[model samples]
Target: MFVKICSKSELPEGGVFRFDPETAEKAIVVCNEGGEYYAIGDKCSHGNWSLAEGLLENCHLECVLHGSSFNLKTGWPDKRPATKPVKVFTVKVEGDDILVDIESGVLLEKPDA
Candidate 1:
């Protein structure tokens, strides 16, 4: 099933919302870059820092903690100190609402934290 994380208006034109599910500390970030919206795991592979607090550009997410950049579309770490990828979710836009499917793992996932 898909989870209704947030509405389109709740996010800024180029901002991200850090989501931490109550059921599990498994967090993710819902990003809105202009009209393109995406969801990715909040955790950074390099460290415990969350990607939601980073900057977004060209569909890439930059980790502020260590300057590691990740492709927001694929969650693939593009820069150093982070060779692994983070989890990515399937995002859908429906009538100003953004939906996320955590099961797809389009962003990837770590089996053992």
Candidate 2:
């Protein structure tokens, strides 16, 4: 099921938001990249650091602990030290609200276009 994380205005372009649900196993990091919204696992695959605390540039979230960069769209590590990709989630924007599907479980790979 889709849960409302925040409003679209609450997260500006290039901004990152972190959400940890009591019923979920992993936290989620929601990003706003030039109006588009993307969600991924908050933990870095390499260092287990929070992706929300990382820098967001060109849709890539860099891990502050080790500089591992993960693409928000695909959850693939663009930079090294991280060979594995993080989990990605389905995001949908409804009116001024931003919603994410964390109940469906994690997505190891990017969904087919």
Best by lDDT: 2
Q: lDDT tens string, model 2, 4-84? A: 999988899999999998723489989999988999988888875788898899889999988889988778887689978
**Weakest 10 consecutive residues, lDDT, candidate 2?**
104-113
Per-candidate Cα lDDT values, in order, are 0.80, 0.86
**Candidate 1 clashes between residue pairs 3 or more apart in a chain or in different chains:** 87-107, 88-107, 88-108
Candidate 1, residues 1-113: lDDT per residue as tens digits? 58888887798788888877763237888898777888888888889888887898888888999998887777888878998988888888888777888776654543342
Question: Which parts of model 2 are misplaced by more than 4 Å?
Answer: 23-25, 108-113
Clashing pairs in 2: none
By TM-score, who's the top model here? Answer: 2
Clashes of 1: 3
Kindly report which residue stretches of model 1 are placed more than 4 angstroms away from their true locations once superposed: 23-25, 107-113
